[model samples]
Structure formats: C-alpha cells, structure tokens
Target: MRSVIDIVDLTAAEIDGLIATAEDIIANPAKYSEKCRGKKLATLFFEPSTRTRLSFEAAMYELGGNVLGFASADSSSATKGETVPDTVRVVGCYADIIAMRHPKEGAPLAASMYSPVPIINAGDGGHSHPTQTLADLLTIKREKGRLSDLTVGFCGDLKFGRTVHSLVKALLRYEGIKLVFISPDELRVPDYIRDELESAGADWLETASLEQAMPELDILYMTRVQKERFFNEADYIRLKDSYILTADKMALGKSDMCVLHPLPRVNEIPMEIDEDSRACYFKQVKNGKYMRMALILKLLEVE
Candidate 1:
C-alpha cells in the first residue's frame, strides 16, 4: 500500500533494514537471485536517462524477474494524449511493479494514485531519486564503516542536484551527521534546502571552495554540473570544469575518504583519478546493483 516517492517516505528503521539487506546481498548474492522470479518490472521513462533505466531493468533481471517497458516517452503512447495516471492504470495491469522517471515534477506522484502495482519514482524532474540515495547510503556504510558521525561533502551543482537533495534528507534521519556543501555562487545549495536543514536541526555549512571541505569529509559525493539546468550554456561551460577532481585533489583529503558520483561525467572528475584506491565510484555503481537486489526483495516481500 506504500510507494517510495521520496527518501523521507522511509523511516529510520526501514532505511536501516534496506542498508542491512543491501550488505546481505553483497555477502550472499546467490540467495537473492531468484527472489522475484516470475515478476515483471515495467520501466516507464519519460526522459532519456540510460543509466537509471538500465539500473532498474538490471535490478529486476538480477532478481530473476523480467523487464518490459519503454526507454523514452516518445516511443510510448505517452507522446500522444495519455495521462500519467491513465498510463499507470494501464501499465499496472501488465506489470507487477513500475519504475517511472519523468521530467515533470509530480508525474510519479500522480501515477501512484491509480497504480495497482507498487510505484517507484526513479527521478521525477529535479525532485527526487530515492534509490540513488540508497546507493549513497550503502557506499558510505561500506566505505566508512558507519553512516552516523561522519562528515559528508557534496560538491558541484548542488542547486539542481536531486541526488544530493535526497541524500541530505535521508542522512538527516540518522544521528550525529554533518554536511559540507561546495558549489559556485550561482549554483549554491538552494534556500529551501537550507531551511529544511535548519528546521531539522541538521548541522551544515556552505563554502565555494572544495579544498576547505575536502580535508574534513569522510565521504565526498561529486555531482555533474548539468548544462540543461543552467539558464545559459555559457555559464555552465564556465563553471563545468571548476570542481574537477584529480590526484592532487585527493592528496588534500584523508587517505580513507571515499569519493562518489551519480555518474555520466563531463570532465568534473578526471580519468586519472580513478586509479586512486579510494576512488569508490566504480564500486559504488556495482553496490547499486546489490542495493537494488535487496530492495526488490524487500519491497516485494513486505506484503
């Protein structure tokens, strides 16, 4: 009867359960392989996000379930006059569960109203990406050995980074967590987020420089500076390479500090940086699959 619309929808205990399940899948992968056999995951992507779409499909496939759906809205009847609720109602008949990514802010929320099957919001506009938040939590737990009491620095285009926003909200659910925000003046963390942090009493600070925050971070989550989110391509071009992470940047941090990204990079992080042992983004991506496997088992088994 519940849908994962945002990170806030998950209680602290439930989030802990998910993280524990993710780690369990990592340790015992074979046990989770046939958990969702005969089920079907329908991916309804209104936008062109190959990574997110593929991740969802792969998650279902790895769970011994089949995947069926469209990669973009154009290829589906959505391009015509079909409403989100209507589409969900129709797709729910054929799909055991639905994962939808839309460009509209409340599209997934709208669909969940009539969906017979459980609905998951993949990335509704710049609003939320809860599963990616799951990946972030798992990465921090695996890399740092704990989530609470560790400082996390979120660098790059924070103003429009949905992953950062969702992760911040989820992190607030834990105790003794602190955040350091790094972004250019124009792309700084928005006031609404600052208000939420203050209201929740989550300790945080903002800075334009990454080096100042780097040394203190237990985990550094880097996000891409999206050009489409900017008013002008020129401003994005100007700031795109400003926060580039290389060996020298890693040299400024603690040796155990882990680096993460919700990827598809555009020079924000250099290729040479991947050679560093602490560069955990690749492993983070793999962890994403295990996390998804755990989640598929959890959500489906809950009822």
Candidate 2:
C-alpha cells in the first residue's frame, strides 16, 4: 500500500481523480455510504485537534467504517514515551488505514516508512497537511469550476500555515495559476516555498496589503495567526490582527470570489462576512469530509 506524507506523493492526475471521486460522492451519497463497511481507520493524533480529527472520523463513519485512536498524545502510548514507528506498527495490525497528526515535523513520514497499512498525514507540525490541500483543491474545483487560470490570494500567517504551504505547492502544478501572498513581513511565505515557485516558473507576488490584493483574486484564502506556533507572546499579539477580513474587505474582492479558511478560525474572518455569497469557509469544512472519504477509499484501493 502507498502512503500520502506530502501532496507531491500524489500526482496531479491522482489529485484530479480524487477530486472527481469526491464530487461523485457528494452527488450520490447513498451509493458510497457502505463502500467501506468492514474497514477500520486508525487516527493517531499526537496533537489536539477539532476539525481535522472530527472530519476524518466523520468521513470514515459516513463510509460505514469504524474509527479508533486518540485525539492527543497524553491519551496515547506516546505519553509513556513509545515512539512513532512502534505505535504505527501496532495500530496497523488493527486498522486497514492510518491517519496521523503530530507536533513534530516529519513524524508521519517516519511512521509511513514502517506502516503496514497506508498512512495519511493529517497534519505534521508546520510541515504539511496534504489532505487539507485535497479538500482545498476539491473546493476550488467545485466553486470556481476549475483550478487553473485563477488568481488566488493567501492572507494571514503564511510562515507557519501548513495549509498555505501545501496548497501553494499543489496549485503550482495547475496551468495559469497566479498566487498572491498577503501577510505581514514577520509572517511572509517561507523562502523554500518562494524558491519552489520561482523554480517552477509560477507567477506569484508578495504583499502586505490584503485589501489591495483582494480585488484581483478569484479565491481569497484566509489563515489564522496560530498562537500555538509562536515562541513569543508579544509577536503573536502584534500579528494576530494583521489581516482581518471584514465586510469592507470582502466588498473589495470580486463578487464571485470564494473565501476559504482551513478553519478553527479565531477573529480573522468576521461573522458578518459569513452571510456574504463569497464566504465558502464553512463549505470548505464540509468539502474536507468528502475529500477525506475519497482519499481513504483511494488509498485502500476500494472501488
């Protein structure tokens, strides 16, 4: 079996296929409801989570599959100092597939090396969240009608936003995609990301002005300034409100542009903007479940 430690682990064609499968699942719910009736999914989240964990569980349940595993390290063998490979080895014996989220970067990658079952990376520190990127791609494809030839603006905490990094990498593979990086200087997109974009000959621009960049975007992706990723309280405080998407900001964006957040949003996106037609963050969350369901099916080779 194959594991998805990074978005690049799946080719553009594979991504398209997953999006197509998700769209199919979305359109015909009953047809796929019992697709994985006998399967078991093991979620090994060594970090606290809400959306990602619940989404994976919900997805497995919707497929008629049973779910198991802890939501945090304290609840798992890791609290007793058991390592990732040791844990995955045990979990693999019980489950058909595994989805793991860890605080340490590449922990899932390391686990994948020894996993007897397919390993899905839920989130690995600030490294990558490939499944979330799948949700994002499916959302973009559904809302915008295509992933290519669109200007997408990513605002807020780019430096530590794993979703932003993963999505940016995935989007570069599409044709005619232009990226707008909107963040304060302290939280600009990482250099490696920029370097990758440059090497691929992708069009991208970095800016500190969210409002100025909004009008040009077909998709406006807002990310939270994660308090958990900060080393200094002062730095988090100063940058937390750097890019709030108020109604005024939404008005500046194109009328049909979709707004997406990987969610558990704090105050970056105002509740008032949620009523606007452009707000698709909640839809993104729903799409996430469908995408995960598609991914689990694809990885398990279940037709």
Candidate 3:
C-alpha cells in the first residue's frame, strides 16, 4: 500500500532498517533465498538502463520470485501511447509489485497513484532515484563504518545527477556530514538542493576542482555526464570529460577514502584506479542487489 517516489519517502529509521536487512541478507543469503517464493515483480523501464533494471530482476529472482516486464519504451505498451497509469494498472493485476524507470520526471509518481501494488521508483529522469541512494547508503556504511561525521565529495554532473540529489537528501538526515560539491558552474548542484541543505542546517561547499576537494574527502562520489539528459550535443561534449578520476587523482585522497560511481562509466573513472583499495563502486553494485532484495521483501511484506 506504500510507494517510494523519492529517497525522502523513507525516514532515516526506515533506511536504517533496510540497511540492517541488507546486511543480514549479505551475511546469511540462504535465509532470504525463498522469502519471495510465488511472488511476481514487474519492471517497467521506459528508459534505457542496465544496472537498475537487472539489479531489480536479479533481486527478485534471488528471492525465489518470478520477474516480468520490458527493458525499453518500444517494447512496452507506451509506444502505443498507453499512459503510465494505465500500464501499471494492467501490470498491477498480474504482479505483486512494480519497479519503474522513466525518462520523464514524476512518471513513477503518477503510476503510484494508480498502482494497486507497491511502486518502487527505480529512476525518474533527473528527479530522484531512491533505490540507488539505498545502495549508496549501504556502501557508505560498509566502507566508512558510519554515515555521520564524514566529508563526502560529489564530483561531476551535479546538475543532472539524480543519484547525487537523492543521496544528498538522504545524507541530510545524518549528523556531521559535510557535502563538498565538485563541478563547474554549469553543473553545480541545483538551487533546490542548496535551499534544502540550508533548511536542514547541513554544511556544504561548492568547488570546481576535484583534487582540491579530494584531500579533505572521506568519500568521493563520481558521476558521468549523461548525454541523454542533454538537449544539445555541443554542451554534452563540452562537459563530458569534465572530471576524470585517474590513479594520480586517487593518490590525492586519504588512504581510506572510498570512491563511488553510479556507473555506466564513460571515461569519468579510468580503469587504472580500480586496483586501489579505495575504489568501492563495484562493491556498490553488489550492495545494490542486496538493498534491492531487502526493499522487495519489505514492500511485499514477505515476513
């Protein structure tokens, strides 16, 4: 009966609960293997995605559930001009839960209004991506040992990075978290995010240099410049190579500083930095599946 449209939809306590559930699943995988037996999960991805879609399907399958749904708009009824609400209304009849990703902001919210089952917003344009934020939270908790009292630097594509926005909103609930925004003026964190940070009394700073912000960071979140989000090819080309995280750049950070990316990396993070103990992006992918599994169990009330 509940839907998650934004990271803020879940309270800090609920987030903690989900994280604990994910950690438990990680430690005792067999215990959760049959948790969703006989259940069905429908993934309605109206946009292109590999990680989010596959992660949701993988989570459901690992839970002993069946997965159904399309990977793109062309394969779905949307190509026939079927509305999001109508699509979910029909899918809700066939599935126990729905996970949706759309290029249009608020599409998932609109579907939530019509969905009979729980709706999980996988990613909706540049608006929000709650589940990815959950993954980030688990990664941060596991890597840094604690979420609070840390300086987290976000580098590249802040303006259109849904992951950064959602994670920032989630981090605001924790205490002593300093947010360092590293990007050019064109890609600075949106104004609404700034206003929320001020309202929450959270400390944050904006910088154009990643190396300058690197030394002080406990966690560095790198994001790729999304060509799909841009209307102009020229602008995309100009910012696409903005901040590349190479091995030399990693050396500027603390020995334990964790690096993360909501990936599909297009040269933002060079493979040379993968060997460093600080690179947690791959681990973040694995954590994403665990968190998603926890979310599926919670939303399905599978207890």
Candidate 4:
C-alpha cells in the first residue's frame, strides 16, 4: 500500500496530480460528495490538535467517509503501553486508512511498516508534516498562480517548524525557487536542511531581518515559535516575540505577495493583518480540507 510518511513519499508528479485533483474538487464539489461513501478513516492523534485533526475528519466527511479514533494518547490504548505497530495493525483492520500524529519523531514511519492500509503522517514531533505541506502547495498554486519561480520567505522558528521543513523539501523539486530563512540565530534553519538544500543546488539565503527580505519575496510564510518544542523556558521567552508580522512590517512586501501561515497563531501575526488582501492563511485552512479530500481519494484508489 502507498503511504505518505514524508512529503518525499509522493513524487513531484504525484504532488502535482493531487493539486490538480484538489482544484477540480473545489470547482465541482457536488460531484465528489460521495467519492468515499463506504470507506473508513481512523485518526490516531497522540498529541494535541485543532486544525489537523478536524481537517482530516472534515475531509473524510466531505468525501462521505466515516471517521473513528482518539484525540489524545491518554484516551487511547497507548495509555496501557500499546505499541505503534500494534495500534496501527488493529486500526488497519477497521479503517481503510490512518492519519496519525505522535510526539516522537518517525513514529508514523514505524507504524506504516506494519499497517495494511495507507498511513498519513499528521505530524510527528519536530520531524515531518507532509499533509500540511500539501495544503501549503495547493495554497501557493491557487494564490500565486504557480509554484515555481517564486521567492518564498519563511519567518520564525525554522528549527522546529515541521511544516517549513516539509514545504522546503517539496519546493526543492520545482525550478527557479528561492528560499529566504528569517529567524533568530538560535532558531535558524537546521544544518541538515541547509546541507540538503546545498546538495540539491537550491537557491536560498539566511537573514535575521524579515523586513530586509520582505520586498523580495513572493510568499511570506510565517510560523509561530513553538513553546512546546523548547526545553528552556527562558530561551522561549527571549525568542517568542522575535518576529511578529504587523501591517507596518507587511507594507515592505510586494503588493501582489501572499502571506501564509500554518495556523493557530499565537502572536506571530497580529489579528489586524487578517483584513489585508495578502493574508491567505484562512484560505490555506480551507484548502487543507480540499487537499486532504484529494489525498484520501488518491490513497484509497478511488476514481
């Protein structure tokens, strides 16, 4: 079975195909209302979630599929020391597919090895969030009219932003894409990610100033500094407010430039900026459901 444990699990062609499918769904919603009429989706979330979990359940419902599973580890058999493989094995029998989020990195990958049905990594600690990247790709395609030949600025918490990492990996496959990393020195993009970008001959640059990079970017991707990912509370306090995107700061960006955020924004983005035409984050949230619906249909091999 085909599973999406990482964004790379799906090829550039497959990603493009999924984007096309999602676009079609957006245009013709009623036609796909019963695409997955008899399928079941199991959402096994070991960590706290609002957007990801709800989006998965909503996507399945939109496709006429049923959803079952837990919202947290304490409510699941994992509280009784149930292993990922065992939990996946059991869920695989009852559901046609599984979307799992865990606190440990690579947990979904481990579960995918033993699952009979397809496994989608909802989020795995600081590791990967492939589905979020899909939503991002679709949003970019819809907003910018194309994905390639664009300057994308990623601001805040680059070190722990799985969505940023996954999106960067997916963007590497496209041509004429330039990545600008904007973060505090302590939260800069990981060296491994830099190494991969360097190895692939991708165009990218690092900056501490979001304003300096703003005008050059076609897409401003904002990310919150995750307090949950920090070991030192003092460090989190020092860096948490390092990059807040305000209207004055956003004025430096191009008029046509789009701003994207994987949501549940704490204070990284001011609420006033939500009124700006450039703010595409809410649209990104809606695109998530479409992309996920397209993913469910593709994974289940439904026509």
Candidate 5:
C-alpha cells in the first residue's frame, strides 16, 4: 500500500539512503543489471514529456524490466473519458508497477488509492514531484558532499514550479538549511511556502535580484517563468531575462557553488554558463536514473 505522493513522506535518513543507493549503482552498474528482470512498469503519462518519460523508461529498462503504457493521454484509454482509478485498475492487470504523470492535482493520489500495484507519482499539476526531489537530493549529496547547513537560492517562477515547492519542503527537514528566493514580486514563492519555512524555523529571505543572493548560495536552483504562469505575455517578456545566469554573474557565487536546473530551461540560463564546472544539471540528470533505480527497487520491496 506504500505510495510515493510527496517528498515529506520520505524521511531525511530514507532520502540519504536513496542517494547512497544511487551512488552505489553508479559505482557498480553490473550488480543491478538484472535487478527487476521480467518485471513490467506501466507509465501512464497524461501529459507529453520527453525527459521524464525517457528517464523512467531508461530506469526500468536498465534494471531488466519491460516498460509499457502510453506516452500521452490522447493515445491512452484516458482520452475516452476513463477515470484515473479505472485507468489504474486496468493497467494494474498488466503492470507489475505503475508510474503516472498527470495534469490534475491529486490524480496520482486517486490512482494510488485503488491501484492493486504499487504507484509512483511521476509529477502532478503544480502540486508535487517527489522523484524529481530525489534527483535533486542525489545531486546535492553528490556535489556538495552533504545537505544540511547550507544556503540554497531559488530563482525565477517559484509560484508554479512544482520542483521548487517540493525541494523547499524537502529541505525543511534538514537542520540549519537556509533559503534565498529571488524573483520578481509577481513570480515570488507563494505564501504557503513562506509560512512553512517560518513554522519550520528555517532561515529564509526574499530578493528581487539574483546577484544579491548569488554570493551567499552554496547551491543555486534555477527555474523558468512560463508565460502561462502569468496573466500576460508582457510580464513574462519583461522578466524573462531578469534572472539569466551568465558567466560574469557566476563569478560572484561561492567557490563551491553548484548550479542546478530541472532541465528544459529556456533562456533563463545563458549557454556560456553551461561550460562552468559548477553547472551540475547534466550530472544531476544522470544521477536521476540511478536514484530512480534505487526508488524502483525500494518501492517494489516495500510490501
């Protein structure tokens, strides 16, 4: 009955364990080559995606498991008005496990409630993305050597970035974690997060300028501001380049600073900055596969 619906459901120790497992897999890939042999993972993605879909397929395939199911909702029975639970019930008959991504908030939770097979929430509507949080944790652990007592900055559209919200909640569990949010007023982190940080006693501050936060950040997490997240295109245009991470600006960051992006970045980060040694988004992505391998193994073991 165990399901991954939120980052908070996993404790700090469990998160660390997943990170360790990812590292272990990276070190010894052959040991896990046939870990999930003959198993099937059903990916029920309601929205279209290249990265998440590919990553999940890669993780399952590398573990000797077969991947089946729809890449987009239009191709699935869901387009015929199939309910989330109904879809899960049908897929459960075929899949040893299910990983779902949906546009509706709590859709995966609804799937988990009725699914006979284990369910993993791939992503949900502005809600939570726990697996991405796992990738972020693995990245943080790999680059910085630890998670707690560090300054982390979040830049760009915080209000709608599910990854940002999930990561903030995940970081709240650690001791002495401080957060710096840099964004225009309209795109700043929401009040719920502000309240969560305050209640958790985690030190946090807001800044309109990325420069002010760069010097203090041990980790800088960047996210894009979508035009849809705003009411008008003008606002998106005006602030689109406001948070751009350039080589010149990166010089202000701490010597050990690691830059991270959830990927599919659009102009928020300069291409030149990609060459920087501290840019860990690509490595972050590679770790995602390993972390997901550990997660697939663990969730399948939970019963």
Candidate 6:
C-alpha cells in the first residue's frame, strides 16, 4: 500500500501529478463526483483540528464516499488508553483508506505500519503535514502560475510549524526556489531543517524582521505561534506576537506577492489585510480540499 507519512514520501514528479489532478478536479468537479462512491475514508484525528479533518471528510463526500471516525481522542477508544496501531488496524478493516492526525510525532508512521489500507498523515505533532504541503504547492502553482524560480518567505513559529517543514522539503526539489525564514531567535527553524537545506545546497536565509525580507518574497507564508506546542506559557506569550503581518508590512511586499497561511489564524494576521489582493490564505483553504481529494483518489487508486 502507498502511504504518505512525510512530504518526502511523494517525489517531485508525484507532487506535480497530484497538483495537475487537483487543478483538473477544480475545473471539472462533476466528472469526479462519483469516483469513490462505494469507498469509505476513516478520519482518525487524535488531536483538535478544524480544516484538516473537515477537508478530508468534505473531500470524501464530494467524491460520493462515506466518512467515519472520531474528531478527538476523548471520543475514541484512545481515551481509554487504546494504542494508535491497534486503533488503525481495526479502522482499516472497515474503511477503504485512513487519514490520521495525532498529537505524538511519528504516531501516523506507527499506525501506517499496522494499517491494511493506505495511510495519509493529516498532521502529527510538529513533525510533518504532507497533505498541507500538497495544498501549499497547489496554491503556489495557481497563485503564482508556477512553483519554481520564486522566493518564499516563511514567517512565525518555524520551530513548530510542520507545514513549514513539509513545504520547505517539497520546495527544495524545484529550481530557483529561495527560502527566507522570518522568525524570532527562540522560534527559529530547527537545526535539522537547516541541515537538510545545506545538504541539498538550496538557497536559504534567516532573518528576524519580516519587513526586511518582505520585498524580496514572491510568497509570504505566515503561521501562528502555536500555544499548544509550547511547554512554557511565558515563552509563548513573549513570542506569540513576534510577527504580525499588518497593512504597513504588506506594503513592503510586491503587489503581486501572494500571502498564504494554514488557517485558524490568530492575531498574527489582522482582518484588515484580508481585503488585500495579495492575501490568498482563504484560497489556500479551498485549495486544501481539492488537493486532499486528489490525494484520496491517488492513494485509493480510484479512476
């Protein structure tokens, strides 16, 4: 079975194929309405989620498939101390495919090992979020009209932003893709990620000021500082407001520069900027559903 635990699980070519399928799905929704009519998708979200969980269920429903499973661990056997693999093994028997989101890193990988059906990692702690990366890729492709030869700025919680990690890995495969890491020192991109960039010989730079990097970025990807990911409340308070993207800051960016964010945004992005033509976060959310639909069809081998 083909399972995607990390963005690396799908090659650059596979990503391109998925993007193409997503575009086709967007253009011709009716043609794929019944592609998975009899199949079922089980969403085992052990953590709290709004977009990812709903996106998966919505994708299945749009494809004329049914969806089952819990939105939280408190509602599942996991609340009674049931293990991930065991839960996945049982769910796999009933569902044709599984999309799992867990609080513990590598939990999806462990579940994938025991699952009979294909496993799609919805999100796992701060490790990786491949499907979100797919959404990011598609959004970049659609908004910018191409994914290559563009400078992307990743702002806020780089340390705990799994979306950032996954997207960075995916973008490295493309040429002329420069990465600008905009974050406070405490929440800087992880060393392991830096190691990967260096190993790949990719062009990347880190800065504390978003304004300084804003002008050069073709895409500004903002992320909220995750209070859930922090162990110290004081630290969270100090860095939570680190990079708020205001209208003044938006002026520093290119007129055609697109802004993207994984939703459930906090004060980092104010309501005023939503009117800006550059704000594509809402577009990113809609594209997320399309990308998940494409991924579901691809993993299930449905025509």
- State the C-alpha lDDT per candidate: 0.86, 0.94, 0.94, 0.95, 0.87, 0.94
> Candidate 5: lDDT over CA atoms?
0.87
Worst 10 residues of 2 by lDDT: 243-252
Q: For each candidate, give its TM-score against the true structure.
A: 0.96, 0.98, 0.99, 0.99, 0.95, 0.99
The residue-by-residue lDDT of candidate 2 on 97-117, one tens digit each, is: 999999998999999999999
Off by over 4 Å in 2: none
After superposing candidate 5 on the true structure, give the runs of residues whose Cα lies further than 4 Å from its correct spot: 227-235
Give the count of colliding residue pairs in each prediction. 0, 0, 0, 0, 0, 0
**Which structure is stronger by TM-score: 2 or 5?**
2
Q: Candidate 1's error at 169, in angstroms?
A: 0.3
TM-score of 6: 0.99
Cα lDDT tens digits, model 6, 118-145, are 9999999988999999999999999899
Pairwise TM-score winner, candidates 4 and 5: 4
Better of 1 and 3 by TM-score: 3
Model 1 lDDT tens row, 73-124: 8999987989999999999999888989998877888998989988888998
lDDT of 3 by residue, 1-303 (tens): 788999999999999999999999999999999999999999999999999999999999999999999999999989899999999999999999999999999999999999999999999998789999999999999998998999999999999999999999999999999999999889999899989999999899999999889899999999999999999999999989999998888889999999999998989988888888899999999999999999999899888
Model 2 gets an lDDT of 0.94
Stretch of 10 with least lDDT, candidate 6? 79-88
Model 5 residue 147 CA deviation (Å) reads: 0.7
Clashing pairs in 1: none
1-303 per-residue lDDT for model 4 (tens digits): 799999999999999999999999999999899999999999999999999999999999999999999999999999999999999999999999999999999999999999999999999998789999999999999998998999999999999999999999999999999999999999998888998899999999999999899989999999999998998999999999999998889899899999999988999998899999999999999999999999999999999
Off by over 4 Å in 4: none
Clashing pairs in 3: none
Candidate 3, residue 56: the lDDT equals 99
